[model samples]
Target chain A: MELFTYENIIGIAAGICTSIAMLPQLIKVIKTKETADLSVTMIGVLIVGVSLWVYYGFLQNEVPIILSNSFSVVVNLTLLICWFLFRKKS
Target chain B: MELFTYENIIGIAAGICTSIAMLPQLIKVIKTKETADLSVTMIGVLIVGVSLWVYYGFLQNEVPIILSNSFSVVVNLTLLICWFLFRKKS
Candidate 1:
């Protein structure tokens, strides 16, 4: 079985994009100390959704899915933490 | 080929979760007319990333990937439009 193929590369690209999609928001929340406008439900749902992706990756033995979703989980978790800490103050 | 398998079901679940993750944010933006804390960069990147996923899906001929990404593209696009419409007013 080929580990790195054209199809997986495309998946990796998609993963990279979606994985880092929330970086700016997380940074903005941390730097500006503003989070009221951000939706808690959305972030929460993302955590659940990305976790499922991680599970799906595990089931499929897809490295990109696992790695990307793991990275996104971390990002989303950071955002959630920031939201909790700063939302009240903002 | 099994169209509905346990693995595919997991993927579909993941897809559904992620696909709808942005709904809350979009709704909040529309309802409150607030966009200050929401990062435009994040949304823009999501659009690009999800589009790649759509392409990846096409390459792989994965229905879940195609459908879920297509849904997310619509959702993210709507969010972007909402950001533009309400960001200024808020």
Candidate 2:
């Protein structure tokens, strides 16, 4: 069996990309204090999704999946909270 | 071995959740015409991420991953374009 296949490489790339995908949004939210336009439902669903991924990782004994999803969950949750905190009160 | 396990269940749930997580955002963007508060970097990175996921899915023969990421990619791209088109003309 080969050590690393193209599939594995692409999966790793996917993992890396997804793991930090929300960072820019978080930074932008923090910097601009703008979250009114962001969708609460999207953030809520993402939190649920990443949480399940983490649980799945734990059940499957996959360390990388667990870590990545855990990070994503935290970041997404932070974004959610930021949305609540920073949204303009018009 | 049992055909379905807790891990598999959670994974499925996660997949379903992530697959549609962006839908709400897409709807919101379309309805409200608001994308200025959104981060282009985040959308760009997410496009790269989901595209890799689609490639990874093709390599691994994961139909669900491919379908989900493909949907996400389209929605994120639309959001990006909306950012370009609908951003306030200030």
Best by lDDT: 1
Give the Cα error of residue A40 in candidate 1, in Å.
3.5
Q: Local distance difference test, per candidate?
A: 0.81, 0.75
Taking the tens digit of each residue's C-alpha lDDT, what string does model 2 give over B9-89? 676678789877767778877888977657788788889988987886666554545666787888889998888889874
Write the residue-wise lDDT of candidate 1 on B1-90 in tens digits. 576988778778889888787677677777888887667888888899899988877886667677888999998898888888887676
Clashes in each model (backbone N, CA, C under 3 Å)?
0, 0
Model 1 chain B: weakest 10-residue lDDT segment is B56-65
Q: Give DockQ: model 1.
A: 0.70
Query: Candidate 2: where are CA atoms >4 Å away?
Result: A1-6, A32-41, A58-64, A80-90, B1-9, B84-90
RMSD of 1: 2.7
Best by TM-score: 1
